[model samples]
Target: MTTCVITSHGGDFFGNDRHLTKLLTGLADYARGCLPADEREPLVKLLAAQQQTEVGTEQTIPAADAGQFAAQLRRIARHRYLRSTKLAEAATLLANAADRAAADGQPWTWRTEAA
Candidate 1:
């Protein structure tokens, strides 16, 4: 088993304004096709938790959502390559990308549902 960690913070940068839910849904679909069936649930749960946590803790959820998205990319690479090296590499790449995106000038968009 491998562990993936994701982190996000406030900053001004590029790639931050993009809609991450759409991106994440695409990535999840891609992972379902590529990764082992057993691994998919954990990945989904982790992502959901991360997103929810972000929404709860931060006024702006996009950066945290982006971090979760990056974590999914790391999970995909881990499933694909089945190597720690590739997992680490992908983790770094995705983390940086998410950070850059979060830093870009854009408002975080979110909708709340009635319970």
Candidate 2:
């Protein structure tokens, strides 16, 4: 019997931080009126609160419609808007908050694909 596992080695690892940042940044894009005639008050509030937080300090990520935010993220990523370095930085910030909120307050770590 023979088995094979395939994976790419060079493409950058789009880990949780990257994904969350993409989502938050994308949410920010749509929340700013890129979306249709709709109000994004909750999202805007959430963004505002996140923006006020300082790195290496307590973060306050407001609770909002995660499903909606994720959907918007997919839309933005599909349109290739998540490719900007600015958005990537924003994602890192958002992800930092998530890590702080995670159980045990542990920072996310990368694992080998082959492991």
Candidate 3:
């Protein structure tokens, strides 16, 4: 299986490609309306770019922006669109990882592993 891994000092998130895609899409959807264009585009674009890569390719949220992105993830986690789904749990995990990274002043990474 191809597994997605999002990690930081305080937390980590692991899921399969389908779940990863759901989490990313869910977050991006929320960001589109809630965040300004400039603040939303890079993260959304980066996630879109990552989805095109082979499993195991790694990507990072620049440290400077991790906090804002994490906040967005948390909001997505609470949003009605994802309620009662595994994707919501995945979003929460991703948020936790990014929140940890921001607190530690480090970048959070997203990557996949072949198992």
Candidate 4:
């Protein structure tokens, strides 16, 4: 399995890429239904961009959107049905990244590697 890792000053998280993609897809769907129209698009786009990255490659989620992104992810993580799942864990990880990024205004970096 390929392990996808998201790194930030706050912490790092690693999980199966396929599993993470599935979880993110769920999150995108949740965002579409629950978030306001303007807030929905960026997160959906971010999640899509993440799913598109190939193994052995890397991507960056810009600092400019960190706080809002974190807030959204936190909200998703808090969803009643999601709270106990890997999806919530992933959401929390990304939220942590955003929180850490706020201090230095650094982008969150994600990469995939052999497990």
Which is the better candidate, 1 or 4, if ranked by TM-score? 4
TM-score of each: 0.34, 0.37, 0.68, 0.73
Q: What is the C-alpha lDDT of each candidate?
A: 0.45, 0.38, 0.62, 0.68
Question: TM-score of the candidate numbered 3?
Answer: 0.68
Between candidates 3 and 4, name the one with more favorable TM-score: 4
Root-mean-square deviation (CA) per prediction: 10.9, 13.1, 4.0, 3.7
Model 4 pairs whose backbones collide = none
Q: What is the C-alpha RMSD, rounded to one decimal, of candidate 1?
A: 10.9
The best candidate in terms of lDDT: 4
Q: Which ten residues in a row have the lowest lDDT in candidate 3?
A: 10-19
What is the C-alpha lDDT profile of model 3 across 47-79, one tens digit per residue? 555445677677777766878777776776677
What's the C-alpha lDDT at position 88 in model 4? Answer: 77
Candidate 2 lDDT for residue 112:
18
lDDT of 4 at 42: 85
The predicted structure with the larger lDDT, 2 or 4, is 4
